[model samples]
Target: MGCASYVKRDEYDATIAELRANDARHDQRLDQIQATLEKRFADYDARFAQFEGRLHVETTAHFAYGKAEVREADKPMLADFAKTLAAHHEGVLVTVEGFTDPAGSASYNKRLGQRRADAVRDFLVSQGLDADQVRTVSYGEADNRQIRPGAWGDDGLANRRVALVIDFVEAVAAR
Candidate 1:
């Protein structure tokens, strides 16, 4: 009976040792997987940062008060901007935003802003830019930049203009 009890104790000890070894192996594998995931995430973050650095925004367009037409003097600037956009044909997005002063009625200002944005967009398209890449938005009087007391003339003119925002899409790495 004593010998039988001793044998049972030995078997129990062996079973516990095997379980401990298996647990150690599993923990090592889990640590390896965790390290791999961390490395992958760090690589992704670095690549995304590099891609974001290449993106750009430009507000180079402006307009006159109560006018939706692109001025003759500004046409050359728009043409140059279009040439720049053409050079970067890879997933470029141009947003033409029209803003107005707080002088006209809300509804009227909205329509005027829309017309101004449309005019700028049309000019860009005519200058060999992709129509699909160019989009228009009317800020009306909501985004007035000359809202100070007794502001007029040049101050108001500053608000009554179109802004061109240029953005680029993520560039995929070549194999």
Candidate 2:
């Protein structure tokens, strides 16, 4: 317990300048991280969308016709994605939404869609993301959702994909 004194002008100025310098360094570091993340997203052709007050990172992993397995080439991208998302962002809920081409009965396609979503969800979990944080859904040959509507077989390759979606508040806030 000692006598209190007001902060001197010079001392206050110096403290503020130091704080500003620290803030600048923090900003620079954040900028660097942003640049790296942007490049990574571009490499995977990932894009962002917002709706219903949530932000989503929309990227797809395609599967072969009548198959739910994730392709070998897509695994690396998804693995890195899992590592990055789990490492940086907390409280992220990923919805592995699956789709299928219109080549089978509606019920069969729906089941196939679900299998696709589950496969991606499992893959992401295997890649290190918490299983509890990822969920699965199936659109099941929704015409409007199709990249090439009513096209099945090889032409429907784009349709046979699971679109990984992340709904995170921090992502929206940062934007």
Candidate 3:
């Protein structure tokens, strides 16, 4: 009976050793997978940064003082911008940011900015851009470039413009 108990103890010890070896192997494999995933994500981040660096806001659509209408002269420029966006940024989201000079009450300027953004959005949609891909936001006097003590006239006109911004989309599974 003593010999039989010794044999059973040895068998149990061997089984535990095998399980420890298997666990170690699994841990090594998980480490390798994590390293590979980390490298891939680093590469993805670098590529995204490069793409973002190349993107610039298109600010060709300038507006007159207190007006939200798209001028006849600026229509062609807007058309070109829409075509470029539609061609290059398919499936990407676009934001039309509207700005205004500090010439009126804050609320009025905000509403005017929104109207200008909407006008630009409508024109872009009319020029073959998907409406769902476009959105509008009013910065109003918040981002007014002409708010300096000595700034006036053309500065205000420059401030009253619509800028087209592109938003990058990433795959949900990656996150």
Candidate number of the best lDDT:
2
How well does model 3 score by local distance difference test? Answer: 0.66
What tens-digit string does per-residue lDDT give for candidate 2 at 84-147? 7788766667888999999999999999999999998999999889988888999999988998
Ranking by TM-score: 2, 3, 1
Clashes of 1: 0
**lDDT per residue as tens, model 1, 8-46:** 888999989986785565445334433543343342211
Clashing pairs in 1: none
Higher-scoring candidate on lDDT, 1 or 2: 2
Ranking by lDDT: 2, 3, 1
Q: Could you tell which candidate, 2 or 3, scores higher by TM-score?
A: 2
- Global Cα RMSD, each model: 18.4, 9.4, 15.7
User: Stretches of candidate 2 above 4 Å error?
Assistant: 1-37, 169-175
Regions more than 4 Å wrong, model 3? 1-54, 143-155, 169-175
For residues 34-132, write the lDDT of model 3, one tens digit per residue: 354334344221111113212335454678888999988778767766775676445545678887887788799899989999999999999989998
Clashing pairs in model 3?
none
